[model samples]
Target: MDEIITRLQRIENLLEHLQAERVSKEFYSIAEVAQMVGRSEYTVREWCRHERVRGQKSRVGCGGTTEWRISHAELLRIQNEGPLPIAKRFG
Candidate 1:
């Protein structure tokens, strides 16, 4: 009984550590975020484009073009809560 409880506690600790390490990254690409959130890459990209989520365009290479990169904190927020509020655009 005591041994079983000890093993359970150890397992829980390991799980917690793994969870922390999972999001310890500074940023995540759209594909990675999509996999984590169980959504399509296109969907995630669209979210970035629509300003539904927080992200920034990062330079992928020496080229002038850039791609979206989401921060770890934003990813956590999206997982726990949801996307940010929709902003009303004024013409």
Candidate 2:
């Protein structure tokens, strides 16, 4: 279908523009995701909150909050579905 083709093209453009940073077989931090998606760390966190990217917020020792851990699967999900809704662009 034309819609599917258009959607894939859009995803391809995003991936190319993002330098197509393929994720490794490990969890990634917000900063890493920001770099991969060419967005800001804040936006990545927002994506986690919005469920755009599946993330885990586990508490560290002494009740300290640990940074979100994103899996490669989430990145693939974004690649298939689309990019996060970033309010501003980053370089």
Candidate 3:
């Protein structure tokens, strides 16, 4: 029973490490965000153009396309806000 408990603890530690690594490595591209929120990439670009979505800019894609790296926190905010008032449609 003690050996089983020790193994379970080790597994728990491994799971925690994996979760941390996943969070650190996780990054969403513009297209990914658009798909996630059911918007168009063009709309997302427009929002970025108008400073709608607040996030840090990051380079993405093989050709180094510029993308706004919206963190999970910002996404939650946007979700709660229920879309930008003026902007009709999102990408």
Candidate 4:
């Protein structure tokens, strides 16, 4: 009975530690973000090229190669903003 109580207490302590730890959501790569938004990777690249949105290079995973990271909040903002309007010219 005492051994079981000790094991339970240990488990409770571990759970508390886990609950206290802060876990951050990792930024997604441009390709991953493109797929997430249901658009081609090139289109995302173009957006970045035109400065339509902000992104940065982040080294995630192995190989030490940096990839473009888009903020989820920024993506949602862009999505909410909708597509750009077409320009009209008058002669």
**Which of the numbered candidates is closest to the native, going by highest lDDT?**
1
TM-score of each: 0.69, 0.55, 0.54, 0.52
lDDT of each: 0.89, 0.78, 0.71, 0.71
Question: lDDT, candidate 3, residue 42?
Answer: 85
Error of 3 at 31 (Å): 1.7
Write the residue-wise lDDT of candidate 3 on 1-91 in tens digits.
9999999999999999999886632455567778878899888766766668775788767998776776776666666784455545433
Strongest candidate by TM-score: 1
Q: Taking the tens digit of each residue's C-alpha lDDT, what string does model 2 give over 1-91?
A: 9999999999999989787575366777888888877889998898887766788986667868687888888877766776665434431
Candidate 2, 73: how far from true, in Å?
Answer: 0.8
- Which run of 10 residues does model 4 get worst, by summed lDDT? 82-91
lDDT string for model 4 (1-91, tens) is 9999999999999999998884534566788868777889988876765666677777867889876788777677667884334324311
Give per-residue CA lDDT, model 1, range 1-91, as digits (tens). 9999999999999999999886578999999999999999998898888888899998888877899999999999989987766667511
Better of 1 and 4 by lDDT: 1
For candidate 3, report its TM-score. 0.54
